[model samples]
Target: MVFPTGSLVNLIAIVLGSCAGMLLGNRLPERVRYIVFCGLGLATLVIGMQMALKTQNPLILVFSILLGGITGELLQIERGLNSLGERLKKRLKSNNLRFVDGFVSATLLFVIGSMAILGPFDEALRGDRTLLYTKSILDCFASVPLAASFGSGVLFSAVPVFLYQGALTLFAGVLQPMLTPAMMNEIIATGGLMILGIALGLLDVKRIPLSNLLPSLVYAGVLSYFFM
Candidate 1:
């Protein structure tokens, strides 16, 4: 298969899944939606904890987040993402919390995992799209409840999912030297931190501008290259 073709399939899966979820959601009671969202949140926290545990050095993760967060805030990355999400929201005439949460949470879920990293690289190096295709299938199913609980904003998340994984697939050769296993672990660990915040937001515990932390993934990789 062509490189990133799997990502295309993945995108299709998420879109179809979201459509199905939206249909199903309209029939569910508000209380049931709330319960499902909470369960997803708790599950997210558990997943984040598991990824975070991959880090060999917590200090590296900490530094990557602090520094990368500062950079992201300065660049207003969250504002940029919000603007994009808002464009879609305005088109739908929705200013709902679930919409925003769905977009943010779906993007995080689809983009943060090891599958995202390995899928693209494997495709580039081995002409193998198995991992990405698998991820797409997984995302397809995962997007259902997320869209059901949140809203159409979950559909918009497919944009980032495509860009992130697609770029990695196309550029894997150039990035190979930089993306060491150690660095990959740190990146996942940093993402786990972001995922934790997403979980809290979903649970109604507290709101987190998790988008602003996106740069930490890059920063963690850089730090890992030099320090690890």
Candidate 2:
């Protein structure tokens, strides 16, 4: 499997979007920021609803959530994340900036979706960059609103995006034998549903503790192993 140059492209987009959003964010008024946030919320909700309808197996979804939530809770991902954020804030001396929210939200948005996982696999296996290209575009757009409200935190998300996707692409070469097409599709669909929940949280329509379900990806992979 070959690595796609698209990962580099995606990184470039995130940096560009963050810089643009930060520059423009300073000029925007509070009202404008509020409106943008509201718009993002709505967009998130729509995205969530759309993805939530993709799953054909409700049982997988149910068990995935249960198992994943337990694992995440035990791992204390949320707390660890908050602690990391607090350290960053203290180091930067930006305690009032709410960097944690932006970092966590943007990271989740960029990483927990079907495209984020599948794009790397496609790129490595087929030298196809289409999925990643599309995802990069969406992330670029999403960064605008996020930057408007969250300052440089939205831009910082690019770091995790790079690490997460880059690692997946790198690992794809070794993992190829385990990932069949049917398995990949199921994983994508499962990830899509998770992204839907993330979208809902972003929209403020529902505050789903998505971090607690991070293990669903693993569960999906396990299920795929048996079913595929």
Candidate 3:
């Protein structure tokens, strides 16, 4: 069996960081946690802007977003994700801005973007897990502050992170061939826009139903195929 060391390390980092954050949270004042959220929001905006700017053609992205949004709405993807988050929150008996809050936010933050996709693809193809390793470190630090405010549910994010990237990594040979360079960039752009939405939501400027746009990632590729 090909050991997925990169993914395993990423999981370990999230768990450790979350646990450490939880411990630190117990001692830190609530104000400190709020500050962390604000900082993360600013950082996310910067990152999102960078990714959004990477697209060579703006029209393709606009169409992709519009179509993807419609598909997501028709499918009720956001509602399903919200329902799942709420149910898990109830089962865990978590209170305030924790549990479901952390899970959804952290999962989206960790799951989308180019690194989450391309990193695994490269790892499987070239045995170079550098991008994933770098991402793991960033996630470790990010998770700490998130767990401080969002609660232990942040730890559960590792589940989606591992599974999503692992699947991509394991099947890189098949998927990579299907995604042309242009398609990949468009997909990354869409993910960046979603990440930007997540940032805006975090900043309390708007409440974006980001999960509703999950189909946007795939739509980006499709749209790119035609535009390319």
TM-score of each: 0.92, 0.89, 0.94
- RMSD to the true structure for each prediction, in A, is 1.9, 2.1, 1.5
Per-residue C-alpha lDDT of model 1 across residues 79-179, encoded as one tens digit per residue: 78778777789888986667866887788788988788888888988988899888988888878878888889998899889988999888888988767
Better of 1 and 3 by TM-score: 3
Candidate 1 off by > 4 Å: 92-97
- Predicted structure with the largest TM-score when compared to the true one: 3
Ranking by TM-score: 3, 1, 2
lDDT per residue for candidate 2 within 1-228, as digits (tens), equals: 455477777877877887787788879998987778887777766665565556556676677778888999999887776676677778878744757778778888888877888888888877788999999998898888787677667777787788888888888878878876665655656666767776666656676767777888788778767754
The lDDT of each candidate is 0.85, 0.76, 0.86
Put down candidate 3 lDDT per residue, 1-228, tens digits, no spaces.
245678888899999999999899889988988888899999999898898887888888888788888998999987886677787778878775667778888989998877888888878988999999999999999899888888878988898899988888888888878999999899999889999998998888997878778898998999889878
Native-to-model Cα distance after best TM-score fit, residue 74 in candidate 3, in Å: 1.8
Rate residue 152 of model 2 by lDDT.
68
Candidate 1 global TM-score: 0.92
